[model samples]
Target: MRVTAVRTTRAPAWQWAGCAALVLLGAVIPVLRFLVFWPMDQWQVDVEVYRQAGVSILIGRPIYDAMTEAPQLLPFTYPPFAALLAIPLALLPFGLVGWLWTALQIAATTAIVWYAGYRLIHRGGSAQPLVLGLLAAPMFWLHPVGDGIRFGQVNAFIVLAALMDLRRPRPRVLSGVAPGVLVGLAMAIKLTPGVFVVHYVINRRWREAGTAIATAAIAWLAAFVAIPSASLAFWGGALQDPARLGPNMGTSNQSIRGVLMRVGPSGGAGVALWLVLIALVGWFGFRLARRAWLRGDTVTEVAAVGLLACLLSPVAWIHHFHWIVVAILAILGADPLRDRRRLVAALVITVWFVCRLPWWGISWIAHDWPPILVGRILQNADLAGALLALWLLAWASAREPRDAEADAVARAGERSAAPGKVERRAASEAG
Candidate 1:
């Protein structure tokens, strides 16, 4: 008897087109609402600051010296290179620039979701479009994505840059150097992404790490050459003042330091507590990342490093928690069937974040609850989520089967089953 092999039909072209159309709609509608309906005063104030810095650069005005309009005088907080990048926005009229900036942010968020799905879910088949659409739809509702678009923040761009670096194939010419270039460019725009350099160090990618440092240095040097006074003022004085960034104890600040500031202790005591938590998170997060690297698990590696950046920063705003996307993807990518508990926990945490529970809960309790209770609960929401994700990732990484061990087990099973197969074949022949 002869058996015929069956072929599976791929998803049709219209299905992919529908997915693309839906993703585009999901990304565009909210951005259009924000641009058209949101009050002028509330319009992406950060973009205004950036545009002003860029204009200052063009007109020979000091960048750090220029401030946003009255009532908020928010100066540019990003590196000089970021101001350089903002020049194009500065040249355009406010209304036009706002529209363009919102569009760009929407694109960036879509790109981030696409990259996450590609890294975590897509398995090189016809399902890519469906997977991307599914990921992007829910991601649009994520608090960080909404907040980033609202504030015209660069969080999405930063996340995208990091993802690109993490997922980029080793280059043929300068194998390890290209990844560093991406990381360095990201760091040049904002210092927070510099944390990824430490990831390179932990993984013993010395060439990549050194290249990142060098690339950053070269970019900074270029900025300094362009505006020596502003560069000196920023690096020498402004960068050292954490107060300049914003109120670290605010609900918007979602890092470990933010939590400690709210409920842990004050002055030296707070500093000490923050230090201890940082040490613990660093140890566990890096260890987990190293393990994932060893196991060739890119999702965990990206998620681990991203979490460390948010937790270790002195002021990771709600928008900065965009890295939570990586954490969510990492959890979903883990063996959900085998690790049902973790999957449930991850879903719960993702829902909490999507609902913006921490901020909403704090607002609800502001008038009725004790300060300590409210502070502890509200301030620690994202931090707690980060901690839980780190723990879960570490646990999953530990349980992941090593390639060699899995192969060995398969070989052993094959050997044990060989005798049965031989006996059955002999019985059939004799019969």
Candidate 2:
């Protein structure tokens, strides 16, 4: 008996070649524009701060010492492990480091969009590339993303780390260990990501949560070994002094504390007000996460947790609002094509962020506008947008769906996981 040969189908040669070209252009264009054309004045002042911290470590100086030589006099505000991470950058020339850092940031931002689109929005087959391309280009222009790049801030990397922990595929052995370690490493670098430990707890991923805490502890110990004095300084004093970080009442500080400091009571009363707001937002946001988990929607859960972290942090600078990318993807994932209201709401939120309306509004308020209420609202646009996004997601998730609607979502998730019809069509065409 004769055996038949198997045939496999592939996209036409031109299609494959065109896709490769697009990917190359997409990566190269942004790096060239950001590194070469962007003014040197904007070449990541925060990165200089980090580099100096590394230099301090090497020279036996305290990492917390203010870099008085720098224009900003910015102190190294991150955890000691972060300073260790900066050592390589410290060894490089500033010019070379800036270019490399910008490129790394661009790659991180692209990864964030790709992960958000694929895992959150479930874009499969050829649609995945299109979705990634669409998100990647606009993502570079978003105020927070641009600001993060400009300052050489680590927010992009932090966001990427969080996504990695949250979206990593389950492995056979020690499945939870990888995610926990990633999150723990993130927290070791910057404290805000500790909020994810709460996420793991709420989800009842005990092993992952424990691993995260343990990993962080190990990192802290290692840093202590490496820089005993600096570690003590950071943990003993510098960490507590919010003033050392930056002006809490400034427009750049977009947390609830910032809002209260600007317009509400001062001193003890302001602190109390901020605590109350934090408790409320934290409760509501975590509740939404649990509800989203129950509904089998991890995207919403991630967005809610991220928003809570930014809103609750003492100093969530404009760059920290990179979490807005999560909110945008979650909105799109929540049946935007079928839900007109959600589609419109998502569009409005995207436009608000893309135009950097909040920062612009703060600038307007500085001109001594009379309508203080509107001015304050616009001035706190980042916080307001975060609240609105959280509310919309909570509301949408809370709505009891029709049986058919729930079934559709379930089916969509199933399809997202498996090969899509488009893939089949491509195969057939090739055959």
Candidate 3:
């Protein structure tokens, strides 16, 4: 009895310590290094774009006009509402705005990972394990997520919005309209998260998809009204400039074109390869969605949609690939501690983390290499990282017929065998 009392006394203390550690580590990434010390003046390629959009929204100029101006500022390429959203930031000094924005983003993203980890650990039950596992995930440590915080990127918000939608079923305008608004704003700002619309549609969320579409259209239209001719010109220029301005963009955009150029191949091959990848991944996603729908499995369907969106996009940046965090978390939420599968998932996540190591710029012997060698190495690492993310996404989407059927059967059994139905009542009455 004395020994039991001692063990019980220690358990709460340990639990408290564990919870504190998890919160600290989860927060440390966004608070470290460049994110910690980087000046607001030294914003990245996209941050500058957002800054321009913010400023434009403040000055009563249309976002599209600012996007298409002589200086060609605000590379946002997003819809009008995003500029409107950033308008508040424009009111503050860049230093203050960027700092506050980063802090808010970190908090939001941390919340998202915390909740997602909980769902995965508890299968939507208690959230203790979820919080702990998120603390453990390498991506939750030091990486692009921090870069996002430092640069004031909206990825964390995007992730949070999607997670909120998937966390439960809500039949409200907010439920349908909010995701659409978030996604539409994301699409307007970056044009990538537009894939979420496709995701909604494939999951038979026609009403939600329509709502998202309308929200995006209205937002874009608002931008158009703010600057009619300039909006048209900007759209035209965006289309016209791409052919002339291929891959001279930056080191970060070492896309298919970059690979082809490095290896002495034609641009056609690069574009062709991206197309092939999109088609293949699209087909795979279709199959997974179909199976999930037939089996009425919402969890797998949402995951497949997110994963396919990342894989199918032509220019998926490291931050863009963070959507896979959702995929892994979703799988874990749907299927808790099945040891073998968890091990495999862990292995894939480990490889992904290793490949993303350079993104932090806290390099080891690799960065110490000669400039040319380092560039090549970084390029290879980036490509490898993208492929690894795609591979994990594909692997996560794979469905064994037997397993899917068994899950379906189990769910069926639950419904049929549930307490106090008419059938149960009738059987009871007869007995």
TM-score of each: 0.84, 0.84, 0.70
Cα error, residue 226 of model 2, in Å, equals: 1.3
Residues 1-431, candidate 3: write the lDDT tens digits. 01110000112455546655665566675566545555534544355566677787556665554542333233555544566566666667665666677667656655555544442432322334334545444545434465575556777777666555543222132433454565565566555566767766766767767767787777778867866654575566653454322243333443444444454345676668767756766777766655554544444454566555555654444555455555555444434455467547645654554455444332433456555556465554554554554455445545432233223222222233333222211111110
Model 3 residue runs over 4 Å out of place are 1-21, 39-45, 60-74, 121-138, 166-182, 200-205, 227-230, 239-251, 254-264, 289-300, 331-336, 354-378, 386-431
lDDT tens digits by residue: candidate 1, 132-199: 67667667667777778787888888887777677522212334446678788889999988888998
Q: What's the ranking of the predictions by lDDT, best on top? A: 2, 1, 3
What residue pairs are clashing in model 2? Answer: none
CA error at residue 82 for candidate 2, angstroms: 0.7
- Which candidate would rank higher by TM-score, 1 or 3? 1
Q: Give the C-alpha miss distance for residue 364 in model 2, angstroms.
A: 2.2
Task: Kindly give the stretch of ten consecutive residues in candidate 2 with the minimal lDDT sum.
Answer: 422-431
Total clashing residue pairs per candidate? 0, 0, 5
Residue 283 of model 1 has an lDDT of 92
lDDT at residue 23 of model 3 (Cα atoms): 59
